[model samples]
Target: MIRFGQLVRVQDGGEYGYAVIGDNQGDYFTENFGAKPAWSPTSKGTVLNPNEVHHRKTVVEDQTITLFIDGQQILSNTMDGLAKGIGAFGFFKDRGMGSVLVDNVKVTKITPERPVDPDNEGVVPVEIKSSDMTVRLDEAFPRVLDYTLTNGKKMQGQPTKIDTIKINNVDIVPEVSLEKVSENSIKYILKAINTENKINADLTILLEVKNNTLEFSVTEIKNNNTSQKTNEEIIRTLEIPNHSLVSVNSSETNANVYGAKISTDTTVNGDTLTEVTDTLRSFNSNYMYAVISNSKLSASMHSNSQYSSGGGANDFVRINPRVKEFESYNSVGLSSSPWIYHRDVMFNEQTLELPEAKVVITEDANDDGVVNWQDGAIAFRDIMYSPVGAESVKDLVAYRIAMNFGSHAQNPFLMTLDGIKKINLHTDTISFTKRLW
Candidate 1:
C-alpha cells in the first residue's frame, strides 16, 4: 500500500489473516513473510468479500507506521525497506491465475496531533495562545539582581538597561509585572553592567519546558563592548517558584571559565548546589560529587588545580533523570580552545538516563561472576589511584571503586578507610559461605 509518498505492501494469508509488506512467492500466500500482519484476517476463506467494501489506510510519522482497515485498527509496525515513500502504487497477481478488484483509493497527508504542555496539564499551547500570556520587567534603570555564590560569597549585578521582556512576543511591563512569564515558557533580555569594569552588555535568559522537564538557559552578548580586555564576566539572576527547586545533578565547565556556575542559594530550599571552576591552565581534575537523599540532592564541583585568570561566563540548565551515579562524572579536563560549555541536568526521577560510558559498581569489575577478597583489593587500589582521566572516557575505573567505598567524601575530600575493611570482610564471608554451600 502507498500513501502520501510512502510505500507499504500487504499480503493476504488464508485462515491466518493478512500481512503487510510481505512477499507472496509462486502467488501462494503464507503466514510467514516480510512484515507481520496488521490485522489477521478472520474471514471464512481468508478471501475478500465481494459484497462488502474493504478499506485500508496506513499512517506514517517519521519511521513509525500504523495501519487501519475498514475504520478498524489492524496493526502498526515500522519497516525501513518501505522508505521509498509514496509514488506509483497498484495491485496485481503475478503467479497463480487470480484477479484483484479495483476500488476507490485515496491518499492524503496526516494531520499532526496537538502537543500537550508539560507544565500546565491541559493548558493550550503557548505559541497558539499568545494574547493570554504576558511578560513584564522593571522599568527602573540600573536594576539590581542579587546572587549568592556556592562558597557563601555574596555578589550583585546591575542591569543598565532593559531591552525587552516578552511573553510570546507580547510586551508586558510596568503595571502588570509578572513574577513568572508562564508555567511553560519564560524569555527576557536586558543590558547588564559587569561588576569588574562596569561594562554593559545584553544578557538573555530563555526558559522552555520539554518532555515533562524545564530547561533554563543564559547567554551573554558582548557585541557592543569596546573594551580591549580578552576576558570578562556577566551575571544575571531570576527568581523561579520555590516549589520547582529540585536536585542539582550536573554542572558543565566552559573551558577557561571558573567559579560557582549555578547555585540555588537564593531559593527557599537550600540543598541544591552546582559549581564549575576553570583557570588559565587546568580545571576540574577531580570529578563532581553528589549527596542525594529522599528529600534533597546536594552536589559540589572539585578541581585539582586552583582557579586564577578570573574570567569566562557560565550557563547551567537543569532538567530531570539519574542513572549510574558512579559513572556520572568520568571526564576531567582542561582545553585551550574557547568553547561555551552547556550541561543538561536531568530531574525526572522515573527516567534513568544512563551515560554512554559507565563504570559498574559490583566487586565483579572483571565480570568473573564471583565476588572475593581479590575484588575487594582491586576496589581499594582504584579508590587510592584512578580518579583522574580524559573527559570523554565516560567510565573511569578508579571513580567506580571510590564511589562504592565512599572515599574522598563531602567537604574537604575526607578519606574513609573503614569502608574498604568492611567490604573486604563482607566479600570474604560471601565467598566462604558459597564454598560451603
Candidate 2:
C-alpha cells in the first residue's frame, strides 16, 4: 500500500519485515509492521521533496537485504530465508495524487536460470475482439439488450433486461451491451431513449472494464429533432468485480434501480431537466446491487471511501436528505475530505488552533471520537503544506511512516480542520473551495 511518498511491502506474511520506501523526513529501513509508529526509526533518510529525483536500489543475497538511496545505504537487515524464493512484484499507489517511478532498473540473477522455448517465445497472441457475440448475462461478454432511440437508431448493451424509469412524465428505456475488447479488458455500452414518445432524447454511455475496475468515459446526450446537445462526455471510473452483470426486475419497471436524479446545466425543451444517468445494477442468484458506486444501491466504493459517481461535479455534491448518519448503504453524498479541505483549512485556521486536537499517525487523528478521513487528511496536509520547525518536519515524516494502511492520495487532513458537511446543499463545511466546482 502507498500514500504520498511512502511505500510499504509485506513479504512472506510480514515475517521478512515490512519495508517503507518514502516518508517526509526521508526514506528509511525498519522492521515496522501493522500500525503507524509515533517516534522516528533510528535508520532513516532525509525528507523527500516533490519532483526531486533520488536513486534507489535494493540488493538481496541469501538471508540479507540492503536498501540504498543516492549511493548511500539506508537500511540493511538479515533474517532467516529473507532472500529465499521467487515472488511476484507489484506497485500500488493510493487515491487522488501519489505516484512512484523506476528508471534503469537492473536485476541480477545469482540463482540458476531456467530455459525458455525459442520456438515462439511462449507469448500468446493478443485477442482483439471476441467473435462469440451471444447475448446472455452469464456468458463471457454478452450483448444482452437492444433499444430503439428517438432517432429510430437501435443499439445493444450488456444488461440482461433493460430497465425503465419515468422522467418528466416520459417513459425512458435503457439498453446495454458488453463486448470483449482484448485479453484483459471488456467494453461496455449503455444507452437510454424514448421511442415515439413525449420525450425525445438519447443518452450514450461507454465504458471499459480492466481487471477489477471499470473506466467510464463521458456520456453523450443528443436532443432528438433539435440542434441542441444536453450532456457532454466526461471521464469517470469505478471498481467492480469481473464477470458481473447489471440486472433489473421486469416487475419494477418504473422503480429506480441505480439512477440518481440530478439537475443538468443544459436545458431540454426550455427546461433544465437534462443531467442524470440510467440505472445499472448487478444480478446473481442471491442478490442485486448497483454497478455505479455513487448510486443509492451501489456495490463498490473508491479508495477514499467515496462513492464512485460516473461524472459531473454537480451530482456529486447533492446529498440525499433521506439517509441517516449510521446507514452504510443508500447514503448519497460527496466525500468530505480533500473535497472540503481548503474550507476546512480556512475555517480551522480562523476559528481553531493548529493541531487543536491530538493527531495520531496511525488510523486516527484528533483523538476526537472516531477514526476516519480526518486523521488521513491531517497527515496529508502536513506533507502538502510543509509546516515549519524541526518537530513539525519530524511529525510529517512520522505521519507518512505511520500510515501503513487504509490511506488515499487525497481527502486526508488534520482533524481540527476536518469536519462533516452536506454535499447537495452549500455550506462552509461541504462546499468545494477549489477549482473542482
Candidate 3:
C-alpha cells in the first residue's frame, strides 16, 4: 500500500490533495478550500501487488496533479479554484494490522522562474514589415502593439498592457529582445529570472512575414529547473484583440462565431429581412483552428500538435480556445478578442518545442470576394480536412460506428444507413459501395 499527497494547505480542516494506491486500485482525491472531498479513480483491481515494492511519484503543478507508479502514469486530475498558499507534503497508510516500510524518499520543487524586476524598463519597440502587412511588438511586454494591413486597416487595437504569460499563477514580465533572423523573419526572445529560486526561463516567439500573412509560432520554451524526470504542467495564453468576431471551427457542425449574431425576419409584405447584430458573446471549446476577423482583414490560428516520449501524439497538448469581449472604441463597433489557450504537462528539460501554429491572414479567406463566416468555414476546411490517406478515413468511420453502436440502448445504425443511401442516390456515376471498395 502506498499513499502520498502534496499542497497540503491545512491539516486541521482537511484542505488538501492526495493520491493513493492500495488493494489493486488507484485514485487521486482532493478537498480544496475545505470543500467536500472529490476524487478521480482509475481502473479498479489494476494497481498494486500484495507483496511487492514499487516506485511511486506524484507531481503537483499549478492546478493539475498527476500520479505515477513504476514509471507508468496512473492518474491525473485538474482541480480548479484550488486553495492559495504554500502547503506541506504527507504520506499515509490505512489503519490496518500490517507493517509498511518506506525508503529512498526524494522531493524537488519544479516550478518555473519569476520575473527579475516587475518594473524594469528598456524595452524598445520593433516592427517587421512584409510586402502587404506590418506588425509591431509591444515595447513593454511580449504582446502585439499593432497589426496593420496594406490597406492601412489596423486589426489589433487597444492591446493588452500587461504581460499575459503566467507561471504558477504569477505573471512573468520577462526581459524582451528581438533578433532579426532574416529580412522577413524575426525572433522575439523573452527571458525571466528568479533570484530567490535560482531558476531561469526562456521563451522564443518566431514571426515570419509572407506576402499577406504574418505567421507567429512559439518555437521554444526552456527552463533550467526541470529535468527529463520531472513532470510539470505549463499553461500559456495567446490573445488577438479587438476583432469583429472570433470563430472556432472544430467540425463541420460545431462552428460558431462569437460577438456576432445573424437573424432573419419576414415582414407583412412577404419580404425577408436579414440583420447582423454584433454583441459580446463568450465562448470556450476545443478547436481545430480559431479565426479572428474584422470587416477588412482576418487571421486564423492553427492547432499546434505535440508528441510525447512514448511515441504517441498527445492530443491534450492544447486544451481550449476562449473568446471574450474586449473594450473597444472602433468605428465598426467590433470589440471582441480571441484567446488561444494551452495547458499541458512537460516531462522533460530539452527545450520543449511545439508544432508551428500558422497564422494565415487574408481579406477574403474563401476567395469568394467576400468576408464573413463562410470565409471562416473555408479556413477551417483548409486546416481540419486537408488531404489524408485512406487509413484516416477508415479510422474515422470506425470511430463513428463505435460511437453509434457501443453500449447504447439507442442505436443509430439504420439512420446512418439511410443517410448513406441518400448520398448514393445523389451520385449516379460513382456508388457509395464502389467508393468504399
Query: In terms of TM-score, which candidate is strongest?
Result: 3
Worst 10 residues of 1 by lDDT: 353-362
Number of the candidate with higher lDDT, 2 or 3 = 3
- Clash count for candidate 2 is 23
| lDDT, residue 261, candidate 3 | 15
Winning model by lDDT: 3
Candidate 2 matches the true fold with a TM-score of 0.22
TM-score versus the correct structure, for each prediction? 0.21, 0.22, 0.45
Q: lDDT by residue for model 1 over 1-437, one digit each (tens)? A: 21011233332331112234223211111122233223232211112333556666656553355656567654554443332223333343322444345567776765444332122223221220122222122223212122222233222112122323322122323221122356545554654443344345454545443321223344333335554233332111121111111122123322111122233355543223223221111112111222211111111111111212212212222211121111232112111111122111222323322111111111243456654323323433322224354443553222214432355344222343455456547656231111100
- The alpha-carbon deviation from the true structure for residue 367 of candidate 1, after best TM-score superposition, in angstroms, is 25
Q: lDDT for every model?
A: 0.28, 0.32, 0.48
- For candidate 3, what is the lDDT? 0.48
Clashes of each: 16, 23, 0
